[model samples]
Target chain A: MSTPSSEQEVHEHGVTEAVISYPQFLWKALGVATDGNALFYVWMTALTAVWLVGINAFAHQIVQGQGLTAMTDHVSWGMYIGNFTFAVGLAAGAVMMVIPAYLYHDEDMHDVVIVGEILAIAAVAVALAFVNVDIGRIDRLWHIIPFIGRFNFPVSMLTWDIIVLPGYFLINLHVVGYLLYMRFLGRKPNPKWYIPVVLLSIVWAVSIHTVTAFLYSGLGGRPFWNSAILAPRFVVSAFVSGPAFIVLALQIVRRFSDFYVGHKPIVTLINILRITAVVNLFLVGAEVFTEFYTGGSHVAAAEYLYFGLHGKNALVPWIWTAVVCNVVAAGIFLTVDPRKNLWIIDVACVMTLFGLWVEKGLGLIVPGFVPSTLHEVVEYLPNALEWKISLGIWALGLIIFTLGLKIAVAVFTGTMHVDAAHDAGEV
Target chain B: MSDPSRRTMLKGAGATLGAAAFARAVAPITEWTNDLSVEGFLQKHYKELTVEDMSAVLARIERETEEQYGAKVSVEDVRPTPGVQFAYALNLSVCIGCRRCAKACHEENNHDRATNNSYIRVLEMTNGSLNLEHGTVTYDHAVPAPGKFYMPVQCHQCDNAPCVRVCPVEATWKESDGIVVVDYDWCIGCRYCEAACPYHARRFNWSKPEIPADEINPDQAYLSNRIRPQGVMEKCTFCLHRTRRGKLPACLEACPTGARVFGNLADPDSEIRWVLENKRVFVLKEDLGTQPRFFYFFDE
Candidate 1:
């Protein structure tokens, strides 16, 4: 909570002026949530309301059993797992920004990269929450802990996922917490503080999405997800959607907060989207070609995805829509200059976000089960209750993100000034 | 900052309502706890349990089943004898798609009556092709229809069990006797095993399995067919309760055409070994390298 006279004066202070102490910083961070702004209060209340509704539904599902979901013997997993997959990609995508900021020393991206990190924190939390809800017994969750319950390590891809997800979460949490705390205390963060940790985070980011892909690819029974290209496809598409989300988030932050986000980071993010979208599309095309051109026993799953398999074509329209959105968004991003025409960039970002949502979220998971083992075709669609429960988890993530971002802005812009009494160590 | 008194009163009211709502949300958990015994809740993992602990757990399960299902069931932890590796052989040439095997499995394993859940899915394929894609499992016509062949698929009980490898918790495993079994109490019901099976052989309890007290299979095993909880996975255990006790599986006994064969593969003179050595026999999806003990063959 230390302000210079002007934006130029802020630079003159060299990001190390001692205008706030450690205790004051904690107080200010906590106080950010208590703002009297009607809009802030309304948004928080709405999120809490949605979360409560979701909890109620979850309780019902737990009591009555997963029969409330649309899943059957043919399709064991549904929207909960689909959303969990999407959230993992989102959490991993923060590394795309972190790499350029730290490794390449992109001066423009250095300050604003924390926004992506904050998003990753929220996304990871939501992903874990979805898994918790997806499991049949919440009371028995202690089984996954080492020693307490026998963990199937080294062999189970799910055990690998369980290890890596929270590992990545803790790395991001520690790195972000250290950097923000240092900044609030008006101290230059030691390179030792985040250097090795950030490097680990960069590799950890790639591992998270790759491990998620391996969860499907390693399953030999599900021919649709058994492709070798799935890992690359996951990473490329994560790069597309993850940056696209941050671009939209940056715009939102610009609208609401006084913290300055330069146009340069937005342009950089767009360039990333353009290249990765094309790569994502290329990988997808390769998958389709191999599936259709080979025309082997494995083609059944691909056929069911694109066309109807024995008159069960619930996902055909959804897959086609995803294809159109991805192709058009990639086309626009490749051709248009986001620097001059911001509106076009906005359109591309929205398309990329929604397109990836459909493609990776539902499109990727549902087809693997349609032509289920024994070659029966049974379509799966998320019922209304599943949607409500999913929205509730999403709302909870947004609340964490909104509150975190608010504190970040308050600290960064020096809006919450430190009092002299607090400097004097008074209670 | 202004009107602190009113703000404090609002906060108090919000706290009270939140507590009330939380209590309502947790009401079902109270019912869940009441349904489960304290002994069952505190039971250790199956492999870690001592013989006395297992007996206590089995007794607790028996009492609970009597209270819940109103059936006096005997739950035993049947162990596999040495040098006895169980195997199954199905004669495709004789199988008439009668689905008696499926029905027998539904009754023997205490499957959900509402869904008529069965581990065995008897798929009827076109006579000229072995492609499982054209197989129909819901055929309501007579047995052995013209231009059709029946293939019954169940837990292959593979040596390289993908289901066992994929479970996050080691709730399911391949026994020394070659049967893959699940600990219903230990399983978190993630259903990864259901997704892992190449045969679609696993069944999940979407709701509390409703089996009429009279219809309930009273002869139950700790590791095999028992009244499964609502959120666990269950599959065919080769009717281990009967098979380990030197009796044929109910499905094999129930088959009118004698299409099913069960024996110990370790015995050279077993009927399954004879079928394997002399008949055109193969396992389903053999290229996946699961090494299933269950084989299908056709008679000349």
Candidate 2:
């Protein structure tokens, strides 16, 4: 995130001479020459270990029924689905960066942009993997294919999701392969593949989360999701969170690696994050007004989300926390002094990312299902297993992202040309 | 960023030409095609069933049932099942403020073991009131204890259902004997039908249905009783398995006061026909013109 943005600001215009920068302590993370794959391997091992332990421990309880889970019928899609939707949203957001950096000549975002696409792909895969884990039947995954046994393409928003996800998968596949090839050959990417797919990928990135929004909003009966605002909420949240997600990754990398991605990219990222976060902030306001202004089922749901209702308090705290965090973080991001202050920017990024994740993941889903779709107020609380699973998935995404950035950092700086040098190096 | 849901309702019901070749066998004249130019995969909604295709689809259904749910189910094509004609007439007036129908549906449909979801919902309404706007069909609280007449609603199985009308991908459709069924495998779980349905009869299996194998009903139809895949849309099939067996729907049998009347609407002499003729019969959201075969009437 910071890597590409700072790298991007330098040579957005005409090609200039390549000048190597002194190895400032801030520039070097992960001690110049550390093994990212080795780190990734250990992290991967930890993930596998946690997954096996949790499954083995809870095997009997799951078999007995979902009593072991914090979820009852009320909060049906609690932790597992929450994590699933969040990961999917992040995947959508990552592509938001991937498309423009390579496709268009957004040279500002040149360095480390491919990492976004890679992260996006891996994120979706991880989201889907969590879904399968939650269901505990990896085999039934094939039923989604229309030709395989049966696949009801009509009437099922999930069916649309099934189509769009893999389509996005294939599109990302080509993009990733192109980037990987470029990285391996130690040259710049060809536009032939990039140009033709660029427009579709942009629209497809929007479609991924918009479709996800529709998955909930299309349900007219679910008062929580039936808002005209759900689609917009998703789009804005994605935009606001996407940049911050990138920045957070960059900060984590900066703290650990020797990827001399300077402060310029971080500032550029901060500027974008501020604009989007403020826009997202306004949308959130409009959503609150539209929902409460109407004073109907949608209003009731909004109230349920913001404040407890009917002797139930499920997501009000999380929702308000997300709202406050977003508002304050956006405020901090927009303030000139704090926006420039690297530490303040990092704090804002963390807040925005956490807020958006809670909003899109937990807030969007739980309220929509609150008082139950069947109108039963079966509030969900994630059990240890649910938490373990949720934590496990989040950890997995971070690990994937971390490993991806490390490779990206190494490539762009050494074999990895400085973000400034890479585009001109090709030219 | 804000688009009006690129997914809108498009009735591809007009593509009966190029599609005629696909189902070149069974009764095409009367079954599926009715002067509609349905486009895309929606065009492949259903071709006329040949004896072979029916057998094939039925066989496929059984195999699917076995493969998906590990239940050796019998899927009878049952082109309008014999002997006891099938009809559903809801006595909206006679329906007490009880939810016996919902309970019955939960038991008979073999709903997911975890949630115990049902195909039936009793809209608790006021007496002599027709506006469903104020009605609350989803009641988690204990029911039949207040000032409300419960109208148990399920798939209307309409002659011109909005759910069937606007399905861009025809994963669901009305049968020859006036029943609507969803092919769980063919269904993408897009929930288009759930939205288009005026009665809100359709449900989506957000998670793979968890049904105890021993509790599974072996006599399943391709469109009914089979455990649905996660991410597909499904709804009441009028209990196809039992209806074809010359038996009553679980809801009809469950009513404590026999408030429901089940008989073939096609047969003029059926008791349901008698009720439809004698009583002031009505259907949910009649102005939608769904022409639901499920009629509602009050007791005299």
Candidate 3:
């Protein structure tokens, strides 16, 4: 553990004069992750169990065929794709913390910005998993690899997604890795390495969500998604979910750990949530107005989503539940002050997260295929296997997040550092 | 040499055991991969394959078909004709609600038996409307029910096909003959093309197509009616295997009332050209600008 005198010495010297090698730092990080409290072990064990169940379901899906799922020719993409879409939004939302911390130069935000980046990494991993599971032939995935495979670049928005998503993941990994490594060495981090990358990540984050929205909107055949406002709506909704998730994460970190998260950062995040939640609701209103008011042949999907079409109304309840959640959450965010009543903020954050998941995931992707292209209404609902698989993916994501946060907290708090044995030639 | 070497050996043994355990855990994936041959996995896209490569691929497919389905199928690599482009037209007034063409497509294209799958869906619509939303494919009553008319829809083989445009791997594309086709072997089976097509023209093979060995179509073209593998996209190719060999589509020949017209649009005297010139023929959802090669005309 670092003492006051040692901390003073580090500040004065600007860098640690005696530092251990990279390997030693990594060894220490592993220790930090593995050596945790009883609660951490239990949580990790539960997550692993769920993850195994998911893998089993996915294997069964592969063996039995995608026919085991509810997807048909009419509704070709279902739970996997819907979850993939929502996870991408979550990944994009993580940049909200980055924007405030880096652009605004808020010192308090800088202390906890790593949480958002780690979440981004976890979210992207989950997104990729959803995509892998959704694929009809996961073995033939190499066909889309550029040069080695016939990648339809520039023409296909999916290709753009393939490039940006992993690109964002790598970028965040580099930033987080570099920062943690510097902190482990008790050395001052050079802005040259991480600053340019952080700036690139912000722009890359927006591009990823925009490109994802374009994947749907570019399809002129699906008039339900063929709207110009979709890209902006994706961005705005991401802002809502991202900050709401961060606020909850920050609260949890503060409650459980000894890490010093100041009041200012939470307030700053709440302020961001206030504006984004309203803007998200406004975008939803605008989309609903345009879809219903026009009442054209294209309105069949929207009608199916909101008011039910003919006799089938599978999605009507889902959209309304999302609407109620968003409205209530946004109202709470606008009125309640986080300083006085913290539980209210937690409630609101959970609501917004759930609301946005439904809004962006099933509420968006399913409707595009309902009242399918030839005007036949073939409703899709994700079966039990799909739910089990989805739960497993979420568990995998939480595992990543938990392990990442543990290492980050350890490094940031000066509890994990390079062993002095490295300098003594014993390592 | 003493303690450290012993520890290292034990670590190696532990790693091997762990790897073996992991492999056993994922035994289902290993079992699934047994059906996928190394040659099939490494095969190139349809357009990129040379003559030798195509013949080899076609032979591989034939061998696989024989082995898997116990059927002796002849799969060929058929190319487009130099001076011909195909077009189809349907006489809406004459078309009865009976789905003989749909049935012919199912049998001719070697569709899955359990799903009773076909490229064509005959929508029974009310007489006073052209709106497809009001149309129903679930009608079970007698043929040509008094106030109802039927419209059979399939792949239009559109010149500007949304299905072709949205395919992330160029697995589906428009041939030089203006017919949209899918290289079923190359498709990643993301089904993006299925969602992109307004006609719902594309079908995904959710499971292994379960056609009996005796019922399998022996004359198969690699791009047209060859039975697709599970987890790929397939669509109507104007029965190009038959069409390129100077024959009409299976659906056209199967139509009871001569409602379907198929011919080379490049030929000035073709029947499809005469229909387009003489009748008020229109493409479905023309405002989307897909420029479909299939047309419909009502006898007024």
In model 1, what lDDT does residue A161 have? 90
lDDT of 1 by residue, A146-172 (tens): 877889997989998999999998998
Better of 2 and 3 by lDDT: 3
Q: CA shift at A54, candidate 2, in angstroms?
A: 6.3
| Model 3 spans with C-alpha error above 4 angstroms | A1-20, A421-427, B1-25
Candidate 1, CAPRI quality class derived from DockQ: medium
User: How high is the lDDT of residue A11 in model 3?
Assistant: 59
Model 3, span A1-427: residue lDDT tens: 6999877875555333333267677787776665556687678768877887788789888876899899999989988898888899899999989988999999999999999999999999999999999888888899888888988888988999999999999999999999998888766889998999999999999999999999999998899999999999999998888889989999889988878889888899889999999999999899989989999888899999999888999988888988999999999999997999879989989988998899898899999998888888999999999998999999999989988998999989889876554445321
Worst 10 residues of 2 chain A by lDDT: A17-26
Candidate 2 C-alpha lDDT tens digits along B163-241:
6644434556777777888766455443446544556577766555777667887766656876665556778888877
Clashes of each: 0, 48, 0
On residues A197-221, what C-alpha lDDT tens digit does candidate 2 reach at each position?
7557778878888877877776545
Chain B TM-score list for all models = 0.96, 0.74, 0.93
Model 2 residue B282 CA deviation in Å: 5.0
- Superposed Cα RMSD, model 3: 5.0
Looking at candidate 1 chain B, the ten consecutive residues that score lowest on lDDT are: B25-34
